[model samples]
Each structure stands twice: as structure tokens, then as C-alpha cells.
Target chain A: MLIGRPSDITASEITPATVFRKRRALIKAAGLGTMMAWSGLSLGEEPKTKIQDYSKSSYGQEEKLTSYRDITTYNNFYEFGTGKEQPAENVGQFKTTPWTVSIEGEVLKPRKLGIEELMKLAPLEERIYRMRCVEGWSMVIPWVGIPLSSLVKLAQPTGNAKFVELISAADPATMPGVRAPILDWPYVEALRLDEAMHSLTILAVGLYGEILPAQNGAPVRLVVPWKYGFKGGKSIVRIRFVEKMPQTTWMRAAPREYGFYANVNPTVDHPRWSQASERRIGGNVFSRRTPTLMFNGYADQVAQLYAGMDLRKHF
Target chain B: MAPTSIAWIKRGIFLLALGPLIRLFWLGFTDQLGANPVEFIEHSTGTWALVALLLSLAVTPLRLLFNMGWLVSLRRMLGLFMFFYACLHFLAYLWLDHWFDWAGIGADIIKHPYVLVGFLALILSIPLAVTSTDAMIRKLKRRWKTLHLLAYPVAILGVLHYLWLVKKDISQPLIYALILFILLLIRLYYRLKLRRV
Candidate 1:
């Protein structure tokens, strides 16, 4: 399914640069500035992001959030490009408006929905989630979106629907990396039906309380905090509920390396790298890598999802 | 070329070869290394090591192709520079990336094929670097020529290290592999021509 930006927000609605800068200055003067202000580290000028109202949730409330610059700039949305910085640099022309997503296969109420309809399905919640990449790096991002469970409830899946596949957009006009066979076009990821219905699984629309940037999978993307970051398919185009476990893009590309579960388990190391520890993305060179937590420290919330299964075998 | 002129050129090339490290330090001080500073440092050092290795490998072919006997004097410096960057790259992985966690490092080396190959390449380069001095080279004589042939395997392993490290989009590593291939092919052609003569 193809999902675009919410229909309500228009070009004129974006805050003017002058006003945005002035407001930022005021926030700085008021001593209510963000991490960059306190750290005295220059991570370049923060991008002018579109802000939206989102109710704060308790998820990752105690954890320090990664800087907005790092969160946006250091992305792995391969559709834009393969390099971490390429997504932000190459997403200039990526259009997210007028997008629609089709929710089909094994759903009783399978229907297509515009990006706005999806946004309005539930109230936006700002969930601070620890996103861990399979490459042994991580970030604590304050994501703004509704839970995927809300949308699944709306779809009213049939009893036979055992898994749900999340497919990404692969428009060659904007997504330059799709031209190369780096990965199968239209990146796909899947989760067991129960895993999809978990409350922690969110359909992220924005991050840092702003409209999602194209690099960070603007409009709509999956945010499965318990799994490696790659499992959260960016810029989703379709959601297919199926009876059998669906093969994913990474699985097709390198089956031995990437697994269907892709769960964040420190004990089960990736074939090429140790998953025991992850370099916190915003940390300086001297900072010690933090030990990776079970289920990314969301074990209390997600471990039960894989209770009986061997993560190593699945991984 | 005059010995004096060549000596001056060697000095110039030494400073020029130091450019990558200087640039790295400048970027670090300027806070321009982006989000993951360690990764940026690691990638930069690793890339320069390979580049220097390729340049050192090219010296023989380039000198033979141009019939410039004076070029052989510079090969030692280039090879040493490659060793220098490779050391820095390994340090970045050990100190910066893994923080001297020997257990973790050992596990990583054993678990990953790419890491194993890279580690092997660096380990194999040590003897060449140690025996690089004029005294050792003069003492070893004929055996030194045979021993220094280790350069070919080191270069091949360096290229493979990069080729295997990447997940997909092997374009960058592929380019390095192609250059290494052509460099080896040129040397083989020269060897065949010498036999014919």
C-alpha cells in the first residue's frame, strides 16, 4: 500500500524560517534548550522541521533522547540510499503527499486508506524508543505516531492471518538506491500476527514532535522497538496479512546473515559483527559502548512475545 | 634524477602521505566527523590504508612502465605509510570500537570471516614492516626479495577485507578489487616479457 503525508497539512502551514529561528533563540535564552545547547557540541545547524502536537507517553521517559540532528541525519532508509548519511542527503525530492496504503490479504475489513485517514485513526503519541541497528549501533528516538495495533484492530484480521508483511515504497523517481540491486526493490519486513498486535509496535508518522522527514520514513513507517532497526520498514506502501510466514527483503538478500525474527538479542551475534554491545550514535569517540540489553531493554514488554522460541535458531 | 633532488621529493611525499591523518585530526577537532565519530575515524583510516597499499603496489608497475629506476626508492616509504594507516585502523577497531575488550575482540575475530581476513592481513604485514630498514634488507639479500613477495598476498587480503565487510552495494570494494587485479596483471605481463627476453 502507498501511504503519503497527511492531507491536512499544506505548504503554507510550515513555519517560516525567520519565526522558527526567533522561537529557537527564545527557547535558548529561556534556558529551555535541548541536548545540543547543554552539550556545547556543534552538530551543525538543526534542520527546519515541521512541528505537530503529540501527547507524550511514558515509553523511554527516563532515557536520554538522541539529538534531533543525529536522529534525522544518521538514517538507514536504503530506498533513499545505502549509506547512513545518504538518506538525509538524497531525500530532497522524495514526495510523501497524496500517498495511499492498501491493507489486504486475510483481513475481513481490508481497505485502502489515505495517509491522513491513518493518522486520524488514533491520537498521536510521542514514544521514546531505543532503536538498535543490526550493525551494532543504536539511538533513543522520541517518535510520534499511533500504535500499529490500532490499525490492525481497524482492519479486523481473519483468524487464519498468522503474519503481517510491511512493504516499503520503491519509486525510482525519488528513491535513487532502488535502481541498484543493493536490495530487492520495495523493501519488505514481517512480524508474527501477535507481535504485530503488540502495543509497543507503532506506525511512526513523525519524530522529535515534528512531521517525519523523508529520510526517517516520513508519513508512515513501522517502529518495532524490540527488533533490529531494519525490521521496521520505512516509507511503507502496503500491509499484507498472510497465513504463513512471509519472506522479507533482507532474508532474500542474505539469508544466513539476516533472519525472519531479527529480534535484538545480545547473546545471538550476527554472523559478521558482535551484537553484545552497541555504540550509541551520538556519543563521542571516547565514550564506552553501552551493553546491548535484552529486547533492547524492552524485555519486560516484549520478551513474552518470543517465550518458547529459541532466538538463536530463529536469528 | 639527482640524489639531492630525489631526497627533497621524498621529504615532500612524506608530508603529502601524512595528509589523511592530518585531515582526520582536523575533522575531529572541528567536530565535523558526524554522528558516529569512531566509525568515521575507523572508515577513514581503513580506506587510507587500502589506498596506500594500492599506491605502493603500483610503484613497481609504474616504475617498470616508465623505466624510472629512481621510483624504487619511494616504494619503501609508501609501503611503510600503508603499514602506518593499517596500524591506526586496527587501533581504531580495538581501542575505539571495542575499547580493548579482549574477549569481545577475540570473539569478533573468530566469528566474522571478514574480520578474520582483515586481522590476518594486518598480522602478516608485521614482518614486512619490521624488516623494512636498509640494514635488514642488505643482510637478507636474496631471501629478502622472496619474503617481500608477501606484499601481493597482503594487498589481495586488504581488498578482500573491504569486499567482504560491506552488506550490499559492493561498488566501492569492487573498484578496489579491480584496481588490485589490474596491478597484479601488469606485474604478470612484465614477468612474462622478461622470460621471453
Candidate 2:
């Protein structure tokens, strides 16, 4: 139960965007075209793009950034595969180019936005945030994206819309894990309308000064830092605004284990394991286990969203 | 059995039983333990303990069905190896996880039912491991046979320990459960047959 976190991953480096495209091209040339546009499929860049870190004193920023390898490699993207290493190895060829996110359902301006349009809508900023997984392993990652509020404003949700539902891309042909019945395919996660519109919530497009590596949710993915990692669905395909609370994937899969709020509360333990502490990922072999923070240490900004609600129940 | 043949059989099984420990050391040395080494070590050791425990249980059926007395000689080593790995598994949790936080550890034991069973299984194994000596066997002949029967419930508790801890994927633990069920069936079938005879 007390596993140690490592300091920074040092395995295979993320395949650079150019190299990835060339590989996809080579695979196509070799009659493996079906594996095209996966992982590092980049839409054209925004003009004169620059990424800035949203570093602050009170943030749960670790002194050392988790190695890019660990952040990208060890993931819970079951779409690609089930093992921790499965997503890292299998997501290399997931077609993300020509991808579209449908922003419909309860929004006044329902529309489909191309990847380029999505990236350009808001300037991407790098927020080095600490990510705590429901599995009790945690990491500090620098995510580059725009605020979810900005995107929600663009969608123009109707007055009655009370929640934001996100659906991810889960193609059985490409994502082999979808073949297995592990939580309903094409994973769905949701947020209360205010939580979705919170400034801290972002639609992350990139990380480590480049487009997001495929394993870390390529093209576009949600980043609700306060919630558990699974709540942040990767390789998103849909964003729906609904009047009632949408049933999220984990909650639907195991109602007792995963609550809708999924807030990082140490007191509310998963039925199988305690949430009191987590292993920090990266660094030493015997990395120390530290106490998990409330709201994953984002209490200052997001606590008000649940000021009156009982988190243990919602969780 | 001749003295030389008996020595060879015991020695061979003893070295072969060290497989998991050897592989774990190799993985640790090569930095192949993956993202979480503590968990990797804990799981590997615990799984191997279950395997050894189940295999040791299979010995009686193997001996009875095949009428092979030699298989009985392998049981003591296999059963002790189960305890060997069980000790490592418990220590990994006690040292690596709790880090001597007696208060926290005590509270955790009471809090998690799965941990309680796992803890009880480890405590119960000590008597079995300690009394597995040749001298103890001679001192308490019929009683030794009856006392070792304690392994039956211990195996079920061990299987329950595994089945409870898993999150979503019960397949891994279920596989262990299936094997335990088959082993128990074989024993019950043989016991009824022998009683009828």
C-alpha cells in the first residue's frame, strides 16, 4: 500500500511531432495505412505561439517536475489498453488529426469545432499542476491549455444547463481496450456547470512546450485538476451541456467506489483502499509517501464550488 | 527411496522454489520494476505466496492419485516457501507501507477487512512453518497430521485476501479463486472415494 513515487521518468522520450508524422507516413507507405493519424497528429500551429507557466506560491507544485516519461507512459487510458503501460505503447497510432469535438446539447450555439479552431480560441498557458490518481499514485505535471470557462463561454450554454458532460474517442478498431467491457466504451465524464466553468478547469491541448503526447490525451482533453484523474477523459470527442447531472463513467461502473464529485478528499476512501496518502511518482526508487491534499491542493480556487454540498456523498 | 535420490529430489525442488525471489532481484537490479516498485514487490511476493500455498495443497492429491510417495517430500519445502514469501509480503507492507507508524498501522488493521484477513493468514502461517521440522513431526505423529490440516482454512482465507483487494478487474483474483475451487473439489472427491472404500 505504501508505494514510493519516482523522481521524473527517463524511459523513451516522446516521439517528436515531425518524427511521429514521418513514421505514420512510413507505415502508410508500407501498406499499414490503417494505423494513420494516431498519437501525435498535429493541426497547424497558432501564429507566434508561446507557452507561459501559471506557477504560484500556494499551488501543489513539486520542486521537481515529474519526468515526462512517467507522466506520458504510466496512464489510465483504457481506450488504448488496460495495463498502466498499455496506453503508452498502444496509443502511438491513434488517429487524432481531422478530429472534431461536438459542443452540443443544451448550448445555444451548438457547433462542431475543428482541432485548429479549438487551439486558436484561447491562448494556451502552461499550468504546472499536481495530478492525483484514484489509484493513490500522484504526479506534478505542467499542462498547456486554455481555461474551460473560455470554452464554456464560446458554447453559450442555455440558462437551464446545470452540468457539462464530456465523452472521449473510443474506436474499437483502433482502441483495442474498447473490445473489453471495462466501463462502458467511449468513456464519459462530467462536471457540475459551475465546476466546468471554473477558471482552474482547462481544455489542455499540449504539455512540456508541445502538443500533448498521445498518451496524455492528444489534440484536446479536459483538465479538472481537483478531481481524480479518470474524471479528466482523454482524446475527447464530445462536450455536452445538460440540465440534469449526467452519469459519469466511473460512477456508472462502480457507484460505490466512484462518486460524481470525485473530489480529492482524504477522508472519503475508496472501498478497496485508503485515500489518506499517495505515492509521489518520479525520482528515487523508494520515493516517499505523503499525505494527499484536499482538492489536490486546489482548495483556494475550487472549494467555493462545493461550499454547501457534502463531498463524501457526492464522492 | 535411496539416500542419494532423496537428496537430489529435495535439493532440486529447493533451488527451483527460489524462482520468484531470483526474478524479483533481477527486475530490481535492472530497473524494470516499473512506475511503482513497492506495489510491484508487494503484489509479486503475495501472488507467489498464494501459488506456493496452492501448489503445496495439491501435493496430497498428487500423492494419492498417482500413488507417488516422493511428492510428499516436496510438500514441506513448498509449504515453507509459501511462508517465506508471505513473510516478505507482510514485511513489505509493514516496513515499506507503514514505516513503523504503530498507531496508524493498528488503525489500518482494524479499518480494512481485507488487511485483517491477510494479517491473520500471516500470523497463522507461523505455527505451521515452525512445526514443519522433522523432529516436530516425530514428536507429534498423529497430531502433526491433524494440525497441518489448518492449511485448508488458511488457503481459503488467503484466496479471500486476494479477491477483496482488487478494484475493477476481478479476473486476476478470480483465476486464483478458480484454481482454489478445483483443488478443493479434487480433495473432497478423493476423501469421499477413500471413505467409501
Candidate 3:
């Protein structure tokens, strides 16, 4: 839906070249001998440069530079204001220093993990991905985070841990949008354990290699690429493992409108708009409209997981 | 007041009526509307259309309730503004969202209930707008009044379209529905009063 020429994003402070060079330097400085060992063994006949190529592809091409910093910071969380830039301006009042993620329900530990402790569990890696908003606009963002599986493993999910529900902080004093009943405060997002373990699911801490801007979920947020952006709840404060499927914020607001599996499939049209195609963020205005892929183009890795299930029914 | 002064005031009012449309165009050109400029344009114009419709509906009630005869003069202008915004809204959806894919858009209208209602509301507004001029109003007098009655149904359909569009959080839509219901009730009361008289 974004019309007119794209903004001159060339002035972006976080360039792809800088991120690539930094990643290579980080890999070398870490003395990741284990990574080298795995890289050599996993790729039998493939050249050593193949792994670099794979990383490059994931990082995104330098030519197109389709990736961008996730604009959740410029979010209309609505409690703050209706403007997209309001959250970034107003969310500074929120204090994330004393933040703690409450892990409970089906987890064995059932304790709170401080933000610093959580960060120490796994080294952060930047993953550049195309983020499509249901509103039809999109962004390519380089997010810094560890896989959700890493955090789930730290808590030690019990056999009963079937679903993971994430809850955002709900203090109206900070998140003014919480004052209104636009949605139940402390927004919640849930995913199945298998889906949580899918390497793509991340507990993001930063974007563009900088500490996350308060508007962009600040301390931590969920990043589920296969689903629409809303599935990735921002400003997260609590994470609970539950046996039964947890009630998500959007699903509770309108069950008919939002389904539990909010996957981005072009075939399944949103009741209001068709999902058949998406305008890539930084592509050519007229010729760049790309056909949206099923499972957000993660079909090769994730489609079989839902093998016999009816997508439309679930959707 | 002198005749020339009154004429100048009338011309000034006409330009004032053009304010929102000019602002919309300026915003579109400035790129201050956000990432999805087309969607922003569509939403802005659609919101303005709803506001104009509400304003137009208020005219009769204001005249009857407050005995303000001058309010009747503004009704046509408000209705025209609603039509103008509706045109921009439809154009944005057709050009940007559908990329002028007529077949796909036609299929969408048939398949999607929300799109169907939205398209129906838009189509119905066209006749009302076309018959809004003083000449057309006089030429088809009785038929013109009857055709403009379609605005009530179109407004209802417009609200329904909004309600169905949102995936979650019905608060905004519900507020609009409440306002529309009250506006319709006022009209119903006026109609009943006229019949009794």
C-alpha cells in the first residue's frame, strides 16, 4: 500500500557492509573452533566458502539492501498515541534496567531470570529478515538475538510444556495505551514447543547491533518470522510454559479475526484484504511486487511439520 | 452587508471547504504518511469520507432541533466532500492495493464479504453524489430525494465494512457503530414526527 518513491534509506546508519564485517570479526574473536569443526563436517563436498555464502544469503544481499531495522519502536502501541512515532518518543519513561522475565507454568525452574542473566546464556547473532506487517507495509530488519530454543532450554521445559506464552509488561504508568481496553494489557503471544524450537523463532534483544529502542520492545521481544508481525509480541515481561494452548491477546480480542496459527500464507486472504502478493520494502515500485510465499517462504523447513492439518481451518 | 462583501464571503467559504482534500494531497507528496503511503492515503480518505457522511447526517437533525435554516445550505457541500473522499479511497485501493487488477478485484468482491459490502457502499454513494447538484436536484426532485435515501443504507454498509476489516480489537469499529446507530435513530424520529404532522 506504500505508494510514491521509497525514502532514501541510503542514509541509514547501520549499513549491510558494517554488519557483515562486524559479524566476521565477532566469529573470529570468539575463537569458535567448534563452529569450524561443525562447518567442515556438515558440508562434506561443499567448499568452505559455502557456509559464508549461506550466512551471506541469510544476512541479505548488499545490492538490494532490502533489510531494515524493525520499526516496532515507531509503533502506535496506541496506549501512547495513534502516531507510529509516538511509542518511540513516549516509551522512554519505561525502565528496563530492573527487568525480569517470569518463567512459570510448565517449566521445571519456575523462577525469574534477570535481563543480564538471560543475555549471558547465549551469544547474540544478527539475523536479517523480511518482516511483513498485516497492514501491507513491510521492512527488512537486522535483529540481534538468540534462538527461542536457547532460552526455553535454559528453563528446562518439562514433558508437559506443550506451549510457550509470552506476556508484555502492562503498567499503564509507562504504557499509556494500557489505560484503554483496546486490548487486554500486557499483550500475550503463544507458540507450540516444536515451533518454538524451530531455529527461526528468536528472543530478540537488539536491532541494527544497538540496544533495542524502547518503542521496538526495548528489553526483549519475540520474533516469529513465519507468522505476521503481531505474533511477535513486543515489550515482553513474562514467559510461561503451559500444557494447554494459551490464550493470545489478539485471539481473545477477536477469535474470528485472528487464529491461533497466524501464519503468513498468500493463499489465505485476510477477511478484509487479499494476501496473494506483498510489496517488498526496498524493491522497485512498479515491478517489485513479490508473490507472498506459503509459510513466509519457510515452507521447505516448516511445511511438513503441519503435514495433514487443514491450514484454512486452522487459519 | 453589501452585495460584493457577501459574494466574497461565499467564495471564501468554498475555498475553506476544499481544505481537507488539499491537505491529503500535500501529505501524499511529502511522504510523511508512513511506510504504506497508499494505505495511508486510502485510510485517510476513507476516514474523511466517514466524517463527511456523519456531518451530512447531522445537518437535518441540527436544522430541526435548533431551527437553524442555514445548516441546510451546508448539507450538499458535506455530501459532496464525502463523495470526493470516497473516490480517493476507492482509487487508492484499486490502484495501489489491487494494482488495477480488475479480475482479481472482481473476484475479491465476490469472495470476500467485507469487500462486497465496502464495494456496495461505494457504488451506492455514486448515484447520491451524481444527483447532488441543484439542477439535478430540481430535475429529478422526487426521484432525487428517494435516491439520496440510499445514503442511510450506504452508511450502514460503510460501518459494517470497517467492523469486518479489523482482524482484532473491535473497540474503534464499535464506537463508529454506536455513533451511526444514534444518527439513524434521530432520522427515524424526525420521519415519524413528520408523518404524524
Candidate 4:
């Protein structure tokens, strides 16, 4: 989704020479600031104090922060491109201002919520959580958004609101990858109502204190921390509360590979790959790969909910 | 050919096969492979496997299309490279992802469609690689050709496995699909022409 710059920046603010000079100075200042900040560090100093709080969380406290542009722009969304920086570079063309999320299915108040209204519902909160991709790399994102359950409640779901389904925006003009039927365009994700109500499920609007960069699901997106990152569908434009389990985009494409319950558990091996361990995002290359926790290390809070069911069978 | 030269050629092939393995160790040691070394390793190995498979498939076409007979010599080496990469890809998944969780792995083999296809492709390629030697080829004769036909299905399954693994994007897999389609069409046209003749 495109985040338009203010008229001053886009239309006219200063002469080209002055603009270039100012940009150069800003960049120089930023570099100097980083050097000064690093020099201040002592061997005994707490790692958290070394970097900005938000950046600290995403780049583990001890890990050195990569280039801001690299960290912000590069993403693993192969739909856009494979390189980490491809999405940020390619997604600028996505039109996000005139966006509307369609609220349909089992909701009592089925209506489209404009982007502005959606933002007004909840004050943004900065949440630092680990984001593990199925591909094996991970990142810690300080997401800024409101609880997803709050939005689900705003729609006033009916008694049968057992599941919540999210669908991504699909426009081949902008998302060239949509031209191919790799997945039913408009990627879909669902969560049981109880899971949706969990505080960890957020309807993210921003990250790193700025409106989320386009590559990182600009405008609005879901952030289900405990589940694999793909389950948190991006570039979202539709929300459907339903009685039965909706056909999730991935599960629909390959049900056997992607399960309805995509909870992070080391024990559950992906058909071709194992789930026993994960690379902690932002860690050093040689950092020991840690064992994946059941429910992404949130089992104490969420495991009881799945008590009676056999995980292997359900998975 | 002299015995010394023949031994040298065989040694060269074996050493060339070690290229991917050495790069993997280097990346793992230096931390240049990204945050998850195992994943980076697995993905790199999988990609090499795909490239090697494509190269192996190209051998026959190259030989037929250009009459480059020497290209035939590289076929076995390319096919072996494909097997090497496939083994590394599987090992990464088994050692790092599964941690020898056989029950989970067994269940996954049965339950996951993409995994089943990928595993099947790997299994099917085994006999083809084993019987790739000239002596084995001569021994098996007509049966060898039938068994080697499995490469076509293996390629299709490899593409399918990739298609399913990707969550949203299909562009990469689509590219592979287009190339494989062209190769298969070429094979089909030649077969039809020969039959008519």
C-alpha cells in the first residue's frame, strides 16, 4: 500500500540543489550519530541502551543493527521477489489510500470500513515480538497496532462467529505476481474466535513508530505472533467472520502441507522440512539454532486451550 | 584411454561434486548465509538441486539439438550433482528441522502432499542414478530406458513441490514450469517425428 508523502515533499519544498544538499547533510548527520552512539558503548554497558528501544527489540539486544534501509526494505515475500530488499523496492506502486476492507459473511454489521475509520478504532501500541518465517529465518518486529479482537468485536459478529477469515488485496497491475495463479489471488487466513480474541493477535497499522513501510503490509495487516508469519496475511482488504472453517489461502492451495492450526511447534515437521528448530531472526550466523517451542514458546498461555485434541492428528 | 588419464577424469568429477559441500561449510562458518544457517543451507542446496536437475535434463536436448556428443559425458556428473544437492536438502530438513523426530517425519510423509511428491521424486531418481553407469546401463538394456523415464515425472514433482511450498508467490515456480514445459515439448516432438519415420 502506498503512503503518499506530504505536498511539501512531493510537490515543492525547495530548489533541487538545496534539496540535494539537505539530503546529503541529513545522511551525514545520521552516520555521525551512529558512530558517536557506538563509541559511547562500554564492554559492561547494557545492550538495550545501545540502540533505540524499538530497533533494539527487532535486532536482538546483542546483535548489531544492519543498515536501516536493509532492515526496513528487504523482506522474504517471494510473491514480490526473493531478495530481502525486493518488496520495499517493488511495492511502492501499490495504491493504498483509497483502500476499504470488506466485512462480510456471518457478521451482524456487515459494512466496509474505510482506512481512516479503521485507524481511529484503537490507539497504536508498539509490540516487540519474534517473527518466524516457514523458510527458517526470523526477525523481531516492533509492530504498532490494536488488538485484532477489538476490530472483530466492532463488526459485531453473530453467535456463529466461530472463525475469522482475512483476505489480502489483489491487483496485478501493482502486484505483478498476482498475474499467475500461484495462489487464489487475495491471500486468505483464518483464526478461531477464541484465538482471535487473544491479546497477541493484532491488526497492525504501523511499525518502528512510522506507518508501516509498504513492503511490510502498509496501511493494515494482521500479526499473529504465535503462528507462522504467513498466517498473518498482508496487504489485507477483507475480513469475514464465518460459522465453519473457511478455506484459508495456503491450506486451500495445499491442505496437506499447511494445516489449519499452523501453531509453531518443533514437533510438527513441514512435509518436506522439519519444525524441530528455527533460526532466531537477527541473530549472528553461527548463533546456535534453538529448539522451536510448542506454540512458538507461548505454550504456558495457549496450550491449555488445545488440551484434549491430539496435535499430531489435528496438524 | 590410458589408465592414468581415466583415473584423473574420475577424480575431477568427484572433486567438482565437492564444490557445493565446501561452499556450504564456508557459509556456515563465516555467518554470511543469513540469520538461519540451516535454512540458508537448505534453501541453497535445494536451489542447486533444481539447477542440477535442469542441467541434467538439458543434456539430452543439447546432445540432440546441437550434436555436441561431449555433452553426453557431463550427463552422469550433472545427474550425480542433482542427487548430492537433494541429499543435502533432505539432510538439512531432517537434522535441523526435524531433529530426528521420526514419528513426526513419518506422519508428515503420509499427510503432507508436497512432501510426498518431493520424497517420491527423490526416491524415483535413486535407481536412475545407481544404474547410470555404462556397465549397469548395458546390463539393464531396455529396462534402463523405462526406469530413466522417471526423470520426467521427477521434474514435474519437483516443480509441484516448489509451487506448494511458496505461500503466496508463484513467479519462480512458474518460470521453472515454463522451462520444463518447453523441454518436455521438445522431447515429445522428437518422439512423434521418429515414430512417423
* lDDT by candidate, in order shown: 0.87, 0.81, 0.73, 0.72
TM-scores of chain B, in order: 0.98, 0.94, 0.88, 0.89
Model 4, A1-315: lDDT tens digits are 332332212111212223343544676777876654433322111112111222222213443333233345447554465556456556746877888988898888999999878877766566776776675556667677778877888889999889999888878888766766767767788999889989778888776555766677867889887788888888789999999998887788878778887888778777756677666655543355567777876687688768998888767
For A1-315, candidate 2 gives per-residue lDDT tens digits of 222222222343344344554676688787755434432222211111234433233334544677666777788888877677777667645788899999999989999999888877777677788889998899888788888888899999999899999999988888878888976877999999999878889898877666787878887999988888888988998999999898888888888889888999988888777888898876344666899989998898888888898887878
Per-residue lDDT of candidate 2, residues B79-106 (tens digit):
9999999999988888876676787678
Clashing pairs in 1: A1-A102, A1-A237, A1-A238, A2-A100, A4-A99
lDDT of 2 at A280: 81
Stretches of candidate 3 off by over 4 Å are A1-57, A62-83, A281-289, B1-10, B167-179
Could you report the Cα RMSD, in angstroms, for every candidate shown? 6.3, 7.2, 9.8, 9.0
lDDT of 3 at A105: 86
Expressed as tens digits, the lDDT of each residue in A203-226 for candidate 1 is: 999887778888889879999998
Instruction: Order the candidates by TM-score, highest first.
Output: 1, 2, 3, 4
Model 3 error, position A220 (Å) = 0.7
Tell me the deviation in Å of residue B112 in model 2.
1.5
lDDT of 3 by residue, A1-315 (tens): 222221212122223334544555676788885665444333221111211111112543442434333254235465565456567456646777888888888877888889878776776777776676665556677777778998898889899989999988888887777787778777888998899999888888877666666677868888888788888887788888999998898888778767899888888877667778786654322333567878777777788778898889887
Worst 10 residues of 2 chain A by lDDT: A39-48
Error of 2 at A257 (Å): 1.3
- Location of the lowest summed lDDT over 10 successive residues in candidate 4 chain A: A42-51
Q: Which model, 1 or 2, shows the larger DockQ?
A: 1
